[model samples]
Target: MQNSSAFKKRIKRRISGRPHVFFAVCPPGLSGICAKEVARVSQKAEEIFSDKYNISNINVLPGGIEFTTRLKTACLANILMGSATRILMRLATFKADGFRRLEEQIKAIDWELYLPSQTLPDIRVTTHKSRLYHSTAIADRIKPILHDRLFLKEPPRHYDVTGSAAPPPQTLMVRGENDRFELSLDMSGTPLYKRGIKKKIVKAPLRETLAFAILTRLDLSENDIIADPMCGSGTFSLEGAMMQCALPPGTFRSFAFEAWPGFEEKSITHARNRLMAAARTDMGVQPLPHILARDLDQTAIDHLKQTCTRHRVFQRICPVCDDFFNMTPPPIKNNQGVVVLNPPYGIRLDENNDITSLYKEIGHKLAADFKGWRTGIVCPGKKEFHALNLGLSTMPFFHGGLDLYTAIGVIGR
Candidate 1:
């Protein structure tokens, strides 16, 4: 019985309670919006984790957030979150008053947590605001401490470690405020902003997160037919199509967490399987509804087509190169669809500072031609949307770092 108990303890140590920390970074102005998204997602995470593992402690932090989860729950996050950029496992957090203390705290961490057991570890350091302002100086100070702590045969030597057989972890994110230092291991090697598949970008492209935010705000669903006039790079259209189909946004990209220790291949596989299972074969509603993208620029249309191809949603969308006003909607049996437009603000088309004439034309067309349809227009400013005279409630939305409004007009009495 004693031997069996010891054996169980060892097994538990190997497989139980492995905690992971995640950090979600966003653009400066979008932090509050990102925070709200994080809160909603974390709530869902807590419910899922609690139901599965019978645990419930998810923490939200400023500038980003953190949570404690075992290996499987961490994998669940990668599959479930639309808002999170990357997941980081927290090694340790220490308080440091000065350069000496900071170096000592960094060195004291068990390098084995991050380094391979067989190789001599390489280290990199970064600092902000604290006394150790020079990142290179901080890196220099950290090497000897690691050497001493690990009890290496010889004193440490510095070498350029980039792409080395064992490269140091990409960064040691250090932030200093109020005379104290906070250190974190950058688990997300690349910024979450890079969803990996957006290889071709248009001029003044919208970030994926911002695109998702707009979709969320609009309360879009899979059943709705979506159209994007002036669809630069097809971001809104592509994101909308993917969302409607329940496809994972990260399906095309590799995540930072995949490279971490104890991350299970089976869990990721299962998540992907679940996503595939939920994916719909027919993105269009009955009678083959249209998800349309129209633009005046032939180059923009070509770019949109290429982007749609990369996203594997080319078949799901109909791309046309023509003026938005002249574009016609598909005649689907009896279902109504939404028409969305991201028109050029005065900033892009400098020839038109006072866009009242453009807005008036849009209003006239919608009020006359597409009377029964629902129209959503995204404009650079609130006044521009009001100028459209769509006779509907306007909800403010953010697009590409600009404060915009999405005016929803239900055409026809």
Candidate 2:
């Protein structure tokens, strides 16, 4: 009984040192992109918690950013971030060049902080331009460290070779460059981009990150009215609604952090309560500022409706099946809002149509019919961009591995 008590105290200390970290992993060649994303998100959070908390230590990493906080900021990043893939806690970072060095560094830490008894941990490793290029070998090397240290003759009975179980001890993430390794733990089981609720996908569907990019370009506000003219799958509209309502992106899904040792239900509850309390309802006379999504394809419209319903934003949005050129904007409740479109870019052989003509029609309708409204158009190529003839300045953005341009036009009254 004395031995048991001492072991429990040791476990408590280990868990206390393991802080919750939110890592924003960015695509390659876009290194440091996640840092900017983290800063933007952190700024928004500081505004929200201005009275209660003071945000400290915003730092950038190779493919992400790290900040120290006692609150459940991962929940905030999960919901609000558009550019991040996963939000993880940084267990530790140290230099290790080879298998032996990796083992020593990993074994030196107190694994009990992350791993609880009766659970086996899943581990994943990634290497780039390093001596430890074989990730499988690295995983093999670390297995014994865990087995020997934990007093198991074989591996833990709960250990799973398949990735189905929550990784006990912790999920090791080894990133290598130039024969040097940096190891961190993954607190997010799947990429934060999954957002849990979007189970179905459409052809050439925009990722949630790209959708958030479009929203950022628009400079969204809680009270502003927004529309997606070619809102396929309703990604843009749904992300927009969550932003306006101050909903954390992670609210819709489960996180890997929940499985970590010392995870408290009260911490999750406190974070969620703060989010709910911050949620503001629209009480204005007009219907919660129109979030209209229109598409020419009936199939696309059906998919959009299903997605909106699944996300519980169906009632908040107006979906219409009609050609964009023929459709009219819903009567402006206050004549203050913006129209954003993500039209098909002639990328794939099938989508590659005479897009120049399509842009010409879009320009004509915007200039002739929708005066006093601001417009944003996202397209794949420069040739299609010139065809719009909207006389608006253009900004370059990326979506789905393609370089795209957005032309923003302010229609004169």
Prediction RMSDs, each to the true structure: 6.7, 5.0
Task: Score residue 181 of candidate 2 by CA lDDT.
Answer: 67
**TM-score, every prediction:** 0.74, 0.80
Candidate 2 ranges beyond 4 A from true positions: 1-22, 27-54, 116-122, 144-171, 281-286, 311-313, 331-335, 346-352, 409-413
- The number of the candidate with the highest TM-score is 2
Question: Which structure among the candidates has the greatest lDDT?
Answer: 2
- The ten-residue window of minimal lDDT in model 2 covers 154-163
How far does residue 145 in candidate 2 sit from its true spot (Å)?
Answer: 3.4
